[model samples]
Target: MSGCMSSSDESDVSACNHEDQGDASPMEIPADDLATSDEDEEASNPPPTKKQKTLESKKPKTPSQIKKSTVKVGGKCSSTNCSKKALQGGHCFEHGGGYKCSEEGCTKQAKVRGKCVPHSGGNRCTQPDCTKLARLKGLCIAHGGANVCSFQNCTKTVQSKGKCIDHGGGKKCSKRGCHNQVVSDKLCFEHGGGN
Candidate 1:
């Protein structure tokens, strides 16, 4: 057989002269010949340019380098004692971090001024004459706070209803026509009641 092979199977074969054989089976070149051809191709090609060699030698930046690049130069937490990076509104997530209550002396986190719920700080009663903290309804206990007795004109604190035990709010005397409150017995102290 002639050393020349068909073009279809050996289109990449630059070192061989293969004549076109229409619809012929592909020729299998020896492994040693293939290696020699590869070596010859490498020798013929020019070496990489200086810039290409430099780019190939360069490595990707390390994690520390990336972190340093992202670090802020002068940015810091708003809190005087804090040294951490500021995440929002010039403050760290730990010290005065989130949105704070607009009320004076209140450090609670709040979305709006009206809805600022006190977490640790106490809110003053809405009553102008009161200086105590408000428990509910914007007023202290003396100024119509929550959890008061449900009885009319009753200002005492409550166990359940708005009325104190003395005002028939809790368990009352079992005796007929007796409105006195009871202790542990079904009757009051005046009605032979004792626990």
Candidate 2:
């Protein structure tokens, strides 16, 4: 029989008998290279259990990955170029997100109770005989639901900075060296305000 040893039937019997080993003398391993015992070998290089192997196969994910996975529903709208809040189905009402209005032939987003604003979808004013939309405290803007102007003896609603536009409360003209209030398109009456 050939001196080369078969891979099978080899039990704790090591020798330079492989086909590629040739006539070289048996390899000598230093005493320091051997493990002290089976216990030391197990501790140093233990085979992973089924559970451990499963876990090892899975790589740890980052915090952003975890967060993105959790945002499957009720997060930011998924529609393109839309940054509005999401209601359901991962989209905003304007971008076909939430429930559509209940009125027939109406595709607008529902404001309240499955209806649009024009179809009486929102809360009505609580004041007697008032059919206008409620603004604050169950009342409409004309019924004291809005803030009044802060100018002396001024009862008009505030346009900005607690004052009406008549008292210089709105945005000013964008023209250089012009302090006049904007009448149209950010320009004063003298600078293409009507246009």
Candidate 3:
């Protein structure tokens, strides 16, 4: 025959002239050539069935797509004794590594609206006549956001060990014969302690 052959006989007998016959039935393809041609045809054309489309979509992504989908995990800040994650520079916000206040001559880290808390930035306390920054539930630390001193008749915030700074709960100066609170470098300001 001039065209490809299609048979429904019991014996394995088939002939397909793919070059001459542009539109031949898949059943006319020889058994040996079907495996390779089937894969190539599927890859070149979109899947016809919904199940086939879903299966095709589940294939592994290309290298470029994989790179775009990956998330970059941040490392710890490089500042001394700081355990927070690094943001912009090598240090944490408290160690002068984040966005600084936009106001001139201000070096404090910006918490909201590109300005520090003292410069009318960040969420304010919900309590009346209180302008301090909110710590929890829109309330400042002084307004029940934090724990108070355990000492009797004391309303100050707890500094350390359930006690306020006045109750000797804060870090003290490292110098001999000094009981003052540490300002920097484990020493009081009076002992030339400034960062």
Best by lDDT: 3
Steric clash pairs (candidate 1): 5-18, 148-162, 149-162, 149-163, 150-162, 150-163
User: How does each model score on TM-score?
Assistant: 0.26, 0.35, 0.38
Residue 63 of model 2 has an lDDT of: 21
lDDT of 1 by residue, 125-170 (tens): 9988776668788997788786877777777788545577776577
- For candidate 3, lDDT tens digit of each residue in 1-195? 333345454232333433454567544766678898888988999657998755633333222222221211134455466555544444455544456666777766666777778994678899999998998789999888778889999998877999887787898889988876775578764674542
Candidate RMSDs in Å, in order, are 24.1, 19.5, 16.6
Pick by lDDT: 1 or 3, better one: 3
Runs with alpha carbons beyond 4 Å of true place in candidate 3: 1-100, 103-113, 118-121
Tens digits of per-residue lDDT, candidate 2, 39-82, equal 68889898988988656323222222222222334445565666
TM-score for candidate 2, please give it: 0.35
The positional error of residue 99 in candidate 3, measured at the CA in angstroms, is: 8.3
Reference-based lDDT, each prediction: 0.55, 0.62, 0.63
Clashing pairs in 3: none
Clashes of each: 6, 0, 0
